[model samples]
Target chain A: MTPPILELSGLTKSYTAGGAAVAHVVGGVSLKVGRGETYGLVGESGSGKSTIGRLSLRLVEADAGTIRFGGIDLRALSGRELKRLRRRMQIIFQDPFSSLDPRVRIGTALAEPIRLHRLRRGAEVDQRVEELLATVGLSPAHRHRYPHEFSGGPRQRIAIARALAVEPELIVCDEAVSALDVSIQAQILNLLEDLQRDLGVSYLFISHDLGVVRHMAARIGVLYAGRLVEEGPAETIFADPRHPYTRMLLAAAPRLFAGPGAAPRTEIAGAPPSPFDLPPGCAFASRCPFAEARCRTEAPGPDSYRDAGRRAACWRSAELPPQAAEESTARMSPAFRRRLDLLHTARREALA
Target chain B: MSETPPAQDADTSAPVLSIRDLTVRFGQAAPVLDGIDLDIGRGELLCVVGESGSGKSVTALAAMGLLPPAAQISATRMMLGDKAGDVDLAGLGERQLERLRGNRMAMVFQEPMTSLNPVMTIGRQIAEPLIRHHGLDAGEARTRALEMLRQVHVPAPEQRYAQYPHQLSGGLRQRVMIAMALVCRPALLIADEPTTALDVTIQSQILRLIDELRAELDTAVMFITHDLAVVSEIADRVAVIYAGRIVEEGRRAQIFEDPQHPYTLSLFASMPRLVAEDVSGGGRLAPIGGQVPAPGNMPAGCRFAPRCPFAVTRCMAEVPPLAAPAGSAGDGHRVACWRAPLEETLG
Candidate 1:
């Protein structure tokens, strides 16, 4: 698969805060993004999802392991080589408003990246800036507007445009649509999807929102306390998830719209444990309902689950009690239910 | 269908709180809440869903008579229970509103960290509401505060009562806020995004706690939120607000199943689906272009016309009256649109 456009092997990052000893935020996360494949890295807040994103881009130095992009070890690259490598990889931050300098206009923000990468100058730079703006669905006239003048959705579009200016092969979109409204999120998701199809750009999409991840990403990697607990195809993970944590996440996520008899979500009672003080065995063992004696003493390595392509780090992957398969229907607002039902009926007829 | 137990279906004649055409304005500028109307039936939770600057907070603030001095509020009709009659909240004096704020209507703000006093013990903060609103003695208030904390599912209530805001986590602080807001057993409670800052798990717990407490106290609730999912879970009726106006309002089922407004449809379409794909070919998510206009800079005709896909000349040139969309069960369903294609749009 083109040697995986971007690959990370046993990446680890830690921090020493407030005179305390070392705390490993990202213990050892290993995943790969194949050429033109969207790899979703899912985790909760403080789960090292953002840290891994930053580490991949070398925005934050990793304490251990390798980051390989396009057959080059990013960790081993030096000076000009590292900087040159960065031009091909970009990151779209969570908070769009704060990511771009408030003092700079949209056009200027787009221009800086192109200029820094030495991709274009003069007339070429202007044309590239306009192209980037239009690529993200923003009008060229919006170039003069400051960050504050734009809405959250437009600001995010601007950020995406800025990311695309350098024509990066791999873009790390970290919670890109988390702050946006649902309608705006759909627009951005569609934009990103369209861009990927057109540009053949690979993405390491990091987010806490699994539903969004499921829709946009082909392969999914579930992260917990800086460790990759599950990595598999999106369809496999969603339809028949093996990891207990993965199952819990899928259940907790809010469905778009469902009928009256839709199943109630299986809620995980407590929050994820602190990374600094994670338990010795499985990091998720504390919150996992099926935790056993074995789980408390030994962490499970990635093992084949439903297929060879799908792997989950769990002791009870194969022999767990069956989770009651709840009716997986969209939860419609009462007003939308009638419309949704009609639409469903029409769709069925058309399919027949 | 699995019906709720018989015990859960008790009916009452009087709504706990009723508001009509509640308008709050700062000077001559367009009303922040223009002709906003709402009702909270006894023991029912009504969630007001809207984006930022949709006047959700303004509506809550006005209900508590907490508007700034320069602000003007007016309502054709406003009532709290049968006894209070139709007292104009806009005209109510500072002294009367102050007495009613905690005693009859209490509010839980979004951020518990900033809302709770850092210097005071969590116990005292909760107790203060009881002591002032109900005129309870200090000792009794302290006892009641501990009870309230325990009721809100705060473990080791006694120890937590003495701890300051800094010592407790976000979830704990929110519990403390709930305890303080419900200390007086107000007839109506206004929770303004109480769980927005908490994690999803914690958010669910908080919602469950609110539901349980509301049932126990029989207090009507005005829940303000931006998350449609949360509203679907908790709201008995949903109000879709855009630009300080209720574009669509209906029962939870109607709101979800028969959304007529383009904005409402977009909200549902935008929601990330959590199911396996089927013959439906995945419902094409229609994102409404453009931003929600600023309060003062509202459009000439319909507020949502600019962003709506079905916007016609009439929609842009003149304001559309709030009318019932076709195929609605009854009059309760309302939408403000000039040319809402009720049949095609619903599909």
Candidate 2:
């Protein structure tokens, strides 16, 4: 197996608002992304998934822990070294509208990165910009157009092109497709997948939508209140989630279509606990249906299930049933199941 | 609960709201919404599903007579209540429309933060409608406002009453918005993406609250949303809108089980399913290529023809009327597509 292109360990970050600790936004998040692999980080708002993304690129400094790139410790790097390293690590933000300068032409935006990195010179810069545009499925002629001239989907393509300009090995996608329409979102997701294959670029994909993450990522990490509650292969995590919080998330997510005999969606009884005054225990304990006395008073460390290559941080992980298996099957319609089978066999044949 | 009528009987009764050939155009540009037709029965939840430029919100606004003065709205028949006792919303004066707006019908917008007034207390905001419509005194309205808050399941109603909109969480703010909209018990409620801004857990809670409230009040709901999953959950009837037109409308079961329109079929295909078996292949999503045409550059024929996978020469030359298929159950299932029942043509 190839070594991980990016690795973060024991990462912790906090913020103070009005001279008071608001919350530890990212509390001891650790994960690895191998070369050409997609590592998905899923959580709701304030789960610090975005902060993790920012911290990996050192766009936001962590209060503690280490970030390593290509087996080199990034935290110890000086200003010059960090700047040089940033070219190989890029971030694509959620809102494409605000990310790109409205006044700048698309060509200028793409060329600026290549020029700044000294990757191309003179006429070669324009040629490189056009190549980047074509790579993201946009026309070279669109280079002259302003950001406002393009729609949300194409604007996101432009953002991808800009990220690709620096020839980054590890790109962090922070809710990149959340703002797009479903049809448009599918287009972008397919584009990202195609690029991943052709370019062999690894991704740290962060989103609140588990379905999208499951589709894109090989490995998945479920975050709650700035902590990793579960981590496993995407299939194992989706099929048989161990943590109660992960199960609740899967049950709460609305299905694409209601089957003839689907069960009613499970409702999480209470709102998430405030990050500011989180109790000294499981952050999700208050909302967990199976929370016991131990769950309320003691925080559990990661418990590895060696055979499944899965881990869950819950006191009751051993006792918990595999809730996702039955629910996933019952939620899918027969027609969808048939089409999915056809798609799989067709894909496998093409790959072979 | 006994006072509430049966859902089946109510479905057979005259529609609570009916619209025919409703068109809206701003200035001389192409119509934002053209020849739109819909009928929502009493206590039915009709989901208007579409993407951004599909004019779902415009339909809601036109129904409420809340369109800007410059925008032109025309409808052959826009009636509220049954035919015998119908109220012509199109012909009503501004003064009369204002009276019916919040009393007989109410709207809940997508963002509760902006929809609610920041300075005013939540109780006062909720009580405004009760006092205006029911002729209740301030003291009576305040008491009733607390009851409304409780009905929407806002925790600690008394304490929340004094809090400003800024002080409440997103979920709490939305509950307050629901309380304000339903305080008067309107016969028709138009919710424009009420849970779009909320998290999944909060969104489900709000959806359940809306479903329960609609059942108890027996109020017809016109739910506008871009999320197909939300539509699957809350809608009794589904209307698939595309490029300012209702391409298909049918019962939830019919729409999901046997979709007719190409656009609707593509929408279903585009969504990433959450099942585990499907995730192994890492196949590409089925994307409908191209964008929703700008209002000014809309096609003369079928608006969806450009992006439709089943498009033929005729599909780009003429628009199809909304009609039932040749062989189907006599449910009011309708589709406006030249090549509908796509099984025959595409196969």
Candidate 3:
């Protein structure tokens, strides 16, 4: 088998307060992003999904772990060599407004990465920048606008173009589309898919939004208090999530059309355990509906669901009752569905 | 426009809070809320949903009479059925509005951390409204605040009472905000994206809490959100706002099930479905280009026409009136687009 584009094993990171490791932001996470595959790292805020993304890119140094980028050990590499390897990896943050330089033209922002990587030079560099803009569906005229001059959606497209300028094989999209409105988010999502289809770039897509993640990712990793609780194909996980936390996320996601009547979305009672003083058990055990005495005392290893790639960090996942496939969109009334069909067809015909 | 701005049943009864042709602009800018009318019954959960700068929050602030003094506000009618009787909120002086605020009408903002008093104990903050509005003594106010906290289901209300806003979690601070807002049992509660900042699980809990409180207190709730999914879950009626206009307004079923406006339909098509995609995959979200125009620089005709998939010359020239389609029972399902009932026109 081809080596995964990026692989992390036993990745751990803790933020220190006053030189003491007071908070374990990321604790013992392991995952693999296959070549050109979108690996979704999903969790609530402070769950350390972002930390893992940063760790993979070596943006945040992990306290302990092995990071292999296309078979090269990132941890053992020297700083200078790591800097060079950085050319092959890039990141897009949630907010392009702040992530971008206010004073710089959008064209300069895109050119800086290309020039730094020496992907293009002189007249060719300017030409490449224009090409990048066109690639992201932006006009060359937009290259002259400042970051603040553009709206949220366009600003994000500029960010994406910047990410693409480096010609990286893998881009860590840390909540890239989370800030945009629904319609705008759809545009960006489609753009990302198109870019992936054309460029064959892998993405470590980290988002707190499950729906967006479900749409963008082929494989998913559920994070809880800095721990990876579940990792599996997006379809199987959504169809019948093995882990309680995964099920909780599925239950909590706001669905537009959940059959004819509105269904009351459920929430589990407790907050995630503090990373400062984690229990000597599953990080989600406190909130897990099926947690037992053993689950509260002993940390369980990854329980294999089926293939080597599918697993849940729960002692009872194998014996747990199967979750009914959660209801979501497309339960439209016939009238609504008919109208939507007409809308889709008309929009398509016009675009065509 | 012969028709009045389309109106909802307001939960099948007389409106607890009614506003008509409300227009607001700051300084020399264009109106942020352009002739938008809204109604909320005694216990209705009306959701005003739109993207950023769509006048969702401004509408709430305008109704609460909380806009800054610089806002040049005008309205045909802004009536609130306060305990005192029906009062025109627009007619009230700032001082009069202040008296009615937190007493007869309350607001809960998106970020409770900012909306809440950071320096004050959560308990004191909650008790202040009771003391100010109900004329309760400090001790009585404290007791009532604790009860309110409990009602909002804040764990360990006694301990939380002594905690500052910074000491509590995001969800807890939100609960404190709700406790404070509802302590005086206001006639109307305007929650503007109250859960947008929270995690999904926490957001669901807060939404559930608001739904319960709205039901129990019969507080006419104006829930402003950009999330159509959230609207589907909690709204009794929904008003889809765009560029300060209510482009479409209808019952939740009518809006979600049989929306007619191109903007509303596009919004529905644009959202990525949550889970069903796994079961039946091969689906793509409709891509509607163009951002919501800034208030001061809105388009001439249909606000959404710039990005509309089916826009024609007429859409660019004529501002479609917010009215029911050509032939339909006037079920308060109004749409502001020339190509309504798209199945008929497009198909």
Alpha-carbon lDDT, every model: 0.78, 0.85, 0.84
Per-residue lDDT of candidate 1, residues A1-352 (tens digit): 3459998988999888777866789877778898887999998777789999999989999999999998899999887888988889989888987679999988998999899888997999999888888898878898998999987788898989988888989999999988887778878987988899899999999988777887888899998777888889987787778899888876665444432566665655776777668788888898898899989888787653556688889988887655644324533344345444444444345436
Q: Give TM per candidate.
A: 0.91, 0.95, 0.95
Clashes of each: 29, 0, 0
Model 1 residue B319 CA deviation (Å) reads 3.8
lDDT (Cα, tens digit) per residue for candidate 2, span B127-198: 998888889999999999999999999989999999999999998999999899889888899999998888
Error of 3 at A196 (Å): 0.5
**Tens digits of lDDT, candidate 3, B16-43:** 8998999998867667888988888887
lDDT of 2: 0.85
All candidates in order of DockQ, best leading:
3, 2, 1
The candidate with the higher DockQ, 2 or 3, is: 3
- Tens-place lDDT digits, model 2, residues A1-352: 2589999999999888777757778888888898999999999888899999999999999999999999989999998999999999999999987679999999999999899999999999999998999888899999999999998899999999999999999999999999899889988998999899999999999998877898899999999999999998998888888888889888777766553466666666787777787889888888888989988888887563333678898878878865745334444556445444443443345446
Against the correct fold, how does model 2 do in TM-score?
0.95
Ranking by TM-score: 3, 2, 1
